[model samples]
Target: MTKLLFLVADGMGDWPVAELGGRTPLEAAPTPNMDALARRCVAGTARTVPQGMAPGSDVANMSLMGFDPAAHHTGRGPIEAAAQGLELDPDDLVWRLNLVRVAGHGPGDAMLDYSSGHIDTGRSTPLVEDLQAHLGDAVFSFVPGIQYRHLLVQRGGARAPEAALDIRPPHDITGQPQGPDLERFASSPRLAELRRAAARRLEAPANTTQANAIWPWGQGRPLLLPAFRQTFGLRGAVVSAVDLVRGLGRASGMEVAEVPGATGLLDTNYQGKVDAALEFLARGGDFVFLHVEAPDECGHSGVTADKVEAVRRFDERIVGPVVRALQGEDAALLLTCDHFTPLARRTHTPDPVPFLLHHPRLADHALPAFSEAGAAATGLTLERGHDLLPHVLERLRG
Candidate 1:
């Protein structure tokens, strides 16, 4: 039995940075371990985000798991709701709610911070709980998650008139003027009043976090995924800090490992996540999807140095140890990122990201390093991101 490790450094794909000699963060970062692995694996690129779809981590990682997003995607909220193990009715429309800090929202508004400075879960948790207590009756209830990420479910929301409004993701509009999002929220009397009520509570003098507002978007019905063991004949475990990844695992009937201190940020628990994945595999799990969100968070911050350091950490802490631990085992490691969160745009792009599938038994060992440039140089580009998993599975079979 070949143990499979699907390692993902989320949003590590990037465009060339002028400050870093026109090399992407992946190239600028010192990925000695990834470079060494690339020498043995067939280096190539995979388009993780399908064309015409928003390059959210949800969509990209779904593809990485070999599930076509076009078929399985419901929305970001339902996926995260699954992470919480919340049983939802078919008509329940869950919306991803963020504890945002905004100064203005009436006439001229500013999105002071999309994540409310990535508010600590300690502070953000209580605030959301308060909202639930105050506003949650039957139709709307708040669900707390890590950091600023949370959820709001509307009982039978699909039939609500507000469901047709054009909502947007908060991260994509950071440091920008709040536009139709406010008007759309006002269009719904209940949500508009809820927004006002939430502000009074969140902005109270007792509240410390900058989270004075609640931004809700990415609403959809419950998501259903086929069992991984049934679809692929493999018992898989997913290790991730974000609920989005764990939600997918839960929906797919895979084991989801929750590691302590595994914040989806630069300062996350890398060693803890690695131990969880390795332990899962040691105890009869056939595959583990270890995802690191630090690189993606850094990419969203638009700080090139932070992203470079994040990539380096991924290479040193994640890639090096996992490969070394599986030295004597019959294992195959598929290394890749979900999508490109280019610093230039400060958002995800529908561009091809690099990937490498390596097995110790393979004889093809020619590439020197794994990077966006190096992968492109190999001239092997996969059109659909979902195919990358099947390609790696073939290596395990061989």
Candidate 2:
């Protein structure tokens, strides 16, 4: 029997009614299919990790993929670097820099639009290519994102773990959170000079990215771990439109299954994703990792209606096909978010995410469709996210 299908929506933060103008996008949205599945399936809130921890891509993803974030965690740069085929030596220091636009001059109001003025690949790609040419060997390469974010892979060899280079992350409504141990690393005089050099190169007029300058952040290296399949004893493949999810698949020693023209939009190839999942099943995959980026994108832009529509589209286009495939099959199914990315908050939230498990022989309960409000009432209440994998494994073993 096949294991299960794991569908994750990354950076899905939570917001209260007042904060979101009387409805969090997930609560306000019409997710008829998801709600229905939740009613009959095991469902409830699950914490991805502890609150007030450093908001990180790798840590969150590690938890979602059924690994302990504390033991298996690494930096986001290593994952992206691996995904892009950049092999790194153990001595190299890497940072994942987002090329964002910086507005205003002074200290506070300087960083513009956290996302580099909502960059598109067309306008931003050339600038990224040009910067690599001018900077030469000191700087490595930049990977344009499926979303507006860009990846800057630096060439820091032989630098001590406590070097002076610092990351300038986005998030200052209250105050910028310091990265774990990065400040101390940035304190050394030699490392500080290197940091200054990197900053100068980024700020220099000679470089023209057309999306403003880069805001370097999330500095760390690879945290190696056993492959997910090896640890869990399940064969899996990841199907995603976004590069980061695909990158995660690569890190976990899984195939990055492609869905043609999957644009990460509500109007993207939804049917195409469904087809991809079926294809993965045909190719002998016991588990499939799927990701949709639209809801998170709309939340980041604070577009409530749009985010709701994205959720609905996932229901009609993606969920239905997956459910249909499960009919009469031995395969089980699981769906949940990586984290909350509320429209009002415009960032990843620490709140528990709603999750569901569906199988043919499970108890009869009717979840109308997928929505935050209904999920609260679903019979299955999980206390933590890590519980999901073992539970699914047990169900599969049955």
Candidate 3:
């Protein structure tokens, strides 16, 4: 049986950091196994993010799953809604809600940390329950998610006049004045009051949490996609800690292997993910997508050292072990990031990301290590990232 493994380390592509002596985190990190893999694998670049699209995880990961984002993507919220197995009405609008920390109550106040210091689910979950208790009504309901992420459902909001309002993600506006974005939500009469009340409730003196407000963005109706097996002729599974990726797997009718303690942070259970993936493959599953989110979180924080350490850990913990485990198997391994979360920008960029593909029969490109520059040097560029997977499969069966 031909096995396929697609591994993603979120936000691994990055710009050169001055503090790292003009090397990006991926370049600065000593990933010995990845270096050896690149020297013996097909190296290339892929533009996972389409033109004029916001370089978000929802979009990029969709492309990586061999789905065309421009054709299939509805919005970030609905993808996450799928993760929770929410049965949304066709006209119900689902929004990706975040427990965020803002500087003050006024609209002029600067937006603060997006993840609210990555508040634990234990604390954030109760706060969402409070919102559901206080603000959830016939037209709206709140659903708690992991860490600082959550969801809000607006019944039949797809037909509402405010459905056209474009709410920005809190992470993208960190440290900037939030008046304009706040005004966008204010345009929604019902959501406006909900937002204000939620802020007040979260900021109550006794609350004493980093998250002072509930930020709702990325709203849309539910997403729909063709089954992965039907589309690719391969039964596949997804291993990830975040809802966005799990939601994508669910939407595509693939299995999701949930690993306990699989936080999308630095302390995530890397070994558990590796075990789950190998188990799936051993059980005759033709394909698997293994995703790690810690690097992306560090990218959002703009901490160079943290990002470097995260890349090293991914190499040492996830990639290293997986490669060793599959040494004698007839497996094709593909390693890449979904998009670039440039530390300089403190957000995602549409730049092309490096990819290394290792197949049983393919010759090595002889690159010293897997880096943005080494990939470019290969002179192979995939214009549509969604096509890369199918292309690899075709080559495998050739």
TM-scores for every predicted model: 0.97, 0.84, 0.98
Q: What is the lDDT of residue 230 in candidate 3?
A: 97
Clash pairs (backbone) in predicted model 1 = none
* Candidate No. with top TM-score: 3
Q: Give the per-residue Cα lDDT of candidate 1 at 330.
A: 89
Cα lDDT tens digits, model 1, 1-398, are: 89999999999999889989999999999999988888887778888788888899999999999899999898899999999999899999999999897877663677778889988899888888888988898889998988999999999997888667678788888777777788888899999898888888886888988888899898988999988889888999999999999999999999999799999898899999999999999999999999999998888889999999999999999999998899989888888899999999887888898888788777454677788888888888889988888877876686
Model 3, which residues run further than 4 Å from truth? none
Question: Across residues 1-398, which tens digit of lDDT does each residue of candidate 2 receive?
Answer: 66588877655445765744676666666667666676677666676775545555455666777767666555666666666666776656556656555553234444546656555566666655655665536545555554455566555642654323444446332132334323443465544444445455556576555345455555556546569788788888888876656767787898887777777666678787778878888888888888887777676767677777787777767787888777878877787877787766767676677777777667445666655555667656555566668777776576
Displacement of residue 69 (Cα, Å) in model 2 is: 1.3
Candidate 3 structure quality by residue, lDDT tens digits, 139-159: 999999999989999999889
**Alpha carbon lDDT of residue 213, candidate 3?**
87
Residue 227 displacement in candidate 2 (angstroms):
1.6
The candidates, ranked best first by lDDT, are: 3, 1, 2
